[model samples]
Target: MKIKPNKLRSISIVKGQLKNVKFCIGDDPIPTVSEQPVKSLGRWYNASLRDKDQVQQVRQDITNSLENINRTLLPGKLWRLQFGLLPRVMWPLTIYKLPITTVEKLERTMTSCMKKWLDIPRCLTNISLYGKGVLELPITSLTEEYKFSKIRLQMTLKDSRDQTISNAEQPIPSRPQPSSERDRKSPTYALCPTPATLKHILTGCKTSLTQGRYTWRYNQVLKSLAAALESERNSTNSLPLRATNSITAPTFIREGQKKPNHPPTKPETGQLAMARDWKMLVDIGQQLIFPPEIAATTLRPDLVLWSPSLKSVYITELTVP
Candidate 1:
């Protein structure tokens, strides 16, 4: 049988993409500039019926994503490997430097691609081929360091025909970190608070209005918390009043956010000050007094304490940096 004719009959394996993919068969293996079948011939997995079902499900998912096309995939690459009907694939003359993106953006792109791959098994892996054909990859892998998700790829086939691998795409972008491991970023100073301290201060804040200090600044606020600490101890039950309006950063890898019912930022002078004051006081005072009323002897100044004997408020000196 002639090689081209056999190639035509060959299973047009287009695997290794995530969702919503289309596959077309042609004389040449490279799908880019090769002849089209007028319309897309549908998905790739030709031989296995079970694989076809998988291909369809993945294709539909990907199609929906592409239609919505708002989110991203990460920590993986969506790679496509094709086997030439003539054996080896040709390095086609195409532009590779498709676009530049931040580490996050590239990750999203690579994620979308992997979702493509997740949709199907990579076509280029584990296949038999005979003739020599060009592998035209617009993208090239410069460093093995970027092992995955950096838009880096290489092409190879078992048989040889005058096969060439060339890079037409622009250079791959660099990684965010020098190390291969995930970068562990600390929480933002504003969003990240010492939970112990916050409880202490909020427990104390309820007394500010009663103490004839309806409106006070940060320094006065600390003293206000001290008074609240004393009151909570004298009471039969002590618990910081639940804050009706609170804000928090909902998700990491995103910005710190105000909790719903959180006071708004408007009219020039904002509630951010109130929030800041509230957070600082609550963080500090709650630790000292934000708990069920307890026997005075069991308490310590480090975490919380009250002295009925001397009638004094005690707080471990805070090291304000």
Candidate 2:
């Protein structure tokens, strides 16, 4: 049966166990014994590595990280990520380094299987490649696949014919299921965005839903975030950052929650709700580089100004009127 959008439920699947999985209202009704639980975050990628050699080293550094995944797969942890009961567990899981090419391949694969465009969130695909690859999956509600295709995808990489997963193949997941193994599509909900639209929304481009020209203005935000990460890495930065996926902000933030900030007081529910609603109205990289001044406003700016000598960024919140 197709997933019901309003009553839509999410299921996390392990490799070779697709048929055994099941979903029900909320996070209730644990999946069957045949099914393994989904981890809270996308598989974590090394953010510092720039090459294969570096990636290999990163793999070594996080040997213990798998403990988290292993624990998470233990049903309890899986439930947390699925329903996001424990947001902290969501970190450390992000796009390690995926190539843009690989990301495109993933998009094609996801859209093809779904048989229609569904907004697969950037955090949900091959987004970790940003470190060495060009793209990473987003961790947002944008993706609501018929099944856990990506999860099984990574598993296929492990069970490679040669047992040596390709770097290029590292990001582009494999489908182990038989070509004819067509799982029933979940109820498709029109209320939310789809994969095709997310492609543009996350980019510095436009979308069918938003008249806000250059709705992807937030790509700069990611651009900025990338730059910050690079600088932080270069500067012997403190503990690194991670996203449940590649990590980002905007509409992707949990509804009614504010971006991480030490506001003097909790934002009023009215304002928080408004921010949440406006977030969906436009799309931009959840993270990007931009001037500090320009970063504050909710409205899109007409122009961005920077001066290296002064080390400053100036943004003009355009007046349409």
Q: Least accurate stretch of 10 residues (summed lDDT) in model 1?
A: 85-94
Clash number for model 2?
A: 51
Q: Write the per-residue lDDT of candidate 2 for residues 153-245, one digit (tens) a residue.
A: 566676667645633332222233334424212111222333323334334333334533343344455455546434533433232322224
Which ranges in model 2 have alpha carbons more than 4 Å from their true place? Answer: 1-67, 71-75, 80-97, 100-321
TM-scores for all candidates: the values are 0.14, 0.14
In lDDT terms, how accurate is model 1? Answer: 0.34
Report the number of the highest-lDDT candidate: 2
Task: Go through the candidates in order and give each one's C-alpha lDDT.
Answer: 0.34, 0.36
